[model samples]
Target: MAGDTKEGVTLELVTGSAEIFGTDLQLNKKYTFPSGTRTAVFTYQGCTLELIGPTVHAYVSNNTPMAIFANTHAGLEDICRDTENGEASRGFVVLVVGPTDVGKSTLCRILCNYAVRKGRSPIFVDLDVGQNCLTVPGSISAAIVDQLADPVHGFQLEQQISYCFGSTTPTANMPLYELLIRKMAENTAEWMKRSRNACISGMIINTCGYITGEGYKTLLTIAESFEADLVICLEHERLYMDLNRDLPNFVKTLRFPKSSGIEDRSQNVRSYGREAMVQRYFYGTRALPLKPYRIEVPFESVEICQLGAEKLPDSCLPFGVSADDHHTKVVYMKPDMKLQHHLMAVSTAKLISPEVLNHNVFGYVVILEVDLQNHTFALLSPVNELPSKVLIYTEVVFMDDQINL
Candidate 1:
């Protein structure tokens, strides 16, 4: 099929030649793909491919929820006209939520694109620390949609507000995930207040796909954290029903069908997707690859810290050691070979809290080699100098010899 995807997702190039957003894709390569809003793929000779997620048009046609969602945005836009002190005051906040593969993230993008299509600005809040569209995976991030994203280019990462979650799934550290969400909300709210247009332009928050038990409770917590006025639930009838029953009466709930094109991904496919996203983060698109300049940083110059250490019981500890060890918190790491080829984020947080450290990722670093003799670490980074010495190790580690270009 030589058609553009209504949903932006991992599109695998099978055996044939295909051009995604005008850039020809390589055989057997998976892509974080996008095609224009209504653009369709047309093959000249032959092509084979698989789109692994829901399409916006397919989902919209299921019940025309896009029109309904657009209507809601129209109402919010009307409020933007209501100004106080010559500044736009209040606007609607829509939070999209559901389990994985139900088209939640795609919906958020579509809504933002639609708003931008109408010449309106919408802030996209990505709380899906795992599969965030704006930043890398395992991050809570936000970006303002001041202009329409390229159907081929995807969301612009220039002016992004992000916090690194370090791991893919929130289940690994539930409290840390919750803390990141609250921190994301607080920061986003502060940004909204700064700009009259950003405040009145409204925002759409995309949440992680964890909607049962703690995941279900986490939904309410996320909604409350963002002060969401509307919750868009896709596919899962139980989730829609549950949110309606449990959410406050003031909060509006909307349920829509999941696109027929969406597929449930396996673990291997997910791992490949994460690798693809990280690779794309540093290196631009395959058609126009970026040359990431690498330089070595002395081990003594930067501080490396690892998050979520398993706590050892006091009985097993040595006497007179800092009696109250924050085992669950982030602790500094001594130089080791295991740190080789591992990814680290430069911390931006001035005040380090166990929970707040998640938000401080300013830039990424990949340990290239460990020099025991020289006691220096060679690392690859997009930038030359480190933004801050407070570095925290992240979950996704890349191979030293991996082809980023």
Candidate 2:
């Protein structure tokens, strides 16, 4: 069965056993699914459910790729077990790639959850900036999957490390996106060196839905950066063949069919989801309320920079240098009204320019109001105090109705 929750849903297994995203549900216990959740419940045998609250739509289908998914999970388990037994030299990494609404994220979740259930902790790296599950949109994040994800809230955020890329689509800034991915891979490698269980259990990476042209190239880049041992391509034969031909001989590539339950989401729905993620970051949910602090800080106290390539005429450029040569250049910005309603990342870098471009962000703050005359900015942040003075400007603009209050 599959459905999209509108307001919320309380699901109880009426008969037999069932699982969602590879995590088995308790026989008689109730599970709450929050709004905007798209999920599918699967069972080996027959099962019944009692669903409370209204949903956008719900239905049961006889056709599903659950068997193939289970087999794939079993293969990954074998690799993990072999590594643990010293039969393998290093941890195994699996990269999931496909077009939009092809069940890549779902597959990654199922594999991670299955690994955790088998007493293993795998690193879950989410490179989907368009719809990141671990953090807000326009950011790439990674976290160790030591526990099953909540059906409603998804993954926990305690140990997650995220880097803000500022735009939902990598097409807006491909170089920056690639840079962030490489940096994330480096960090994950460092993390693996510390945790033996995590190293042996390996990583499951989820990528964006862009699977053609430059998107295809980005996949190869990711595979090389992470040194993926296996690549799972969902519902895209050309992509599968391309990866198999291009990737190293040691890497294994497999294609899987998309789930019939997976539905294509409209652009408006995607926009709403992105907005909701931003709101949840600062405001929290109804069950767990958060108090965001609104503080006014002098403009001079912080440094604001925007990431972009220098736009100079070819005549003024060096002989061999092109305009796109400096794709990750940091340009300073003067405080102005234009900054209002936009999200700014508090970067960990102490210095400006090169340092800021290389470092990840500490957190984000929304510019509630920009007071140019007073040289100050009214900001709404989850933390009481800003973590850093270096701020990176992003294209994401959040227009909260509660900002006036």
Candidate 3:
């Protein structure tokens, strides 16, 4: 029940119990869809239902926002042309900014889709760790768009170049979040350098919806990192004004209204949306069923590392151990039973240095139980084998739908 999307799906909870993340669905009544976030409907019992999907359809109705965006894209095409002739170092880097549910992701998808239709292979960069675009929530990911996006699954292609924070909000660990973004930008620059197609095709950088204070500052930081050519703001003229007033004069800004059809989600709803995605990941989409296997491994086979944490008060710390170094250091911990049911990302690198550990995740595993009784570790993962020996513990936590003591 957790994987329903807003694009299209209709079902009647027929005979059994089901819940969307933590919200229970009403039985014998019809449910239409998710507002925007990915959802997991856990049918605690063997559930039955009448389901139909992709039920929504529409014509090529060009709204003002899409039209303006597409026109800007046409200008970017000219930038792409310039890049081809060696007149420019890069093509247009479009950065979209807006408050919650103002149709930022939708605009990104539309722009990318339109570009692909025109035969341009732009790289789509998703910085919104709260929404599932190129990859799961809690991660910033990117991918090259060679084909049009599927209405249902989205641009879920290319294994999605990604980096994770394990939490929904960035300000909790702003410095770490900033570092990861810098790393992603650096890697993306390297990717564009090697791929001519991507260079000309440019990129559409989608960002998180936190648009005030540190969030606003973070958006500006990303714009500077990408050297964004144009900044698009939806539903807020003040945001547009602020960006224009502060950013380099060369960076163009767009102020657009909130789309009439956009869905507004509150903080609690946003939290649930991320929860839904984390669940859908290990549990599989309703279109596909993934029976994740649980296995036991020796305690020494892997290491669990956690990213940024708030500093312990100097009063609470041992003498001379100041809080200054607490922010940048990663904790390399010995695995234990306390890690049970915590979701951990498995990475490909051996990762001896914490400085080199802000890397993409290969996959995820949930600690089912840590058997101190036998000095072993138990984990639940979708794939059959471990991708690597390094495990990064994220703030992301998902409770197993199935009851486990």
On lDDT, the leading prediction is: 2
Give per-residue lDDT, candidate 1, residue 343.
Answer: 72
Cα lDDT for residue 119, candidate 2: 91
Q: Give me the candidate number with maximum TM-score.
A: 2
TM values, all candidates: 0.78, 0.93, 0.79
Compared with the true structure, all predictions reach lDDT values of 0.70, 0.85, 0.73
Clashes of each: 3, 0, 6
The residue pairs found clashing in candidate 3 are: 1-40, 1-41, 2-39, 2-40, 2-41, 3-39
Candidate 1 C-alpha lDDT tens digits along 2-87? 22445555666687775432235667776664433223333446677666665444321233344455576666666555643345
lDDT of 2 at 152: 56
Residue-by-residue lDDT tens digits, candidate 2, 55-130: 7677888789889988888888888788889998656899999999999988999988888889989999999988
RMSD to truth, every model: 7.3, 2.2, 8.8
- The C-alpha local distance difference test score for the whole of candidate 1 amounts to 0.70
Clashes of 1: 3
Model 2: residues with Cα > 4 Å off, grouped in runs: 1-6, 34-36, 286-289, 318-321, 402-405
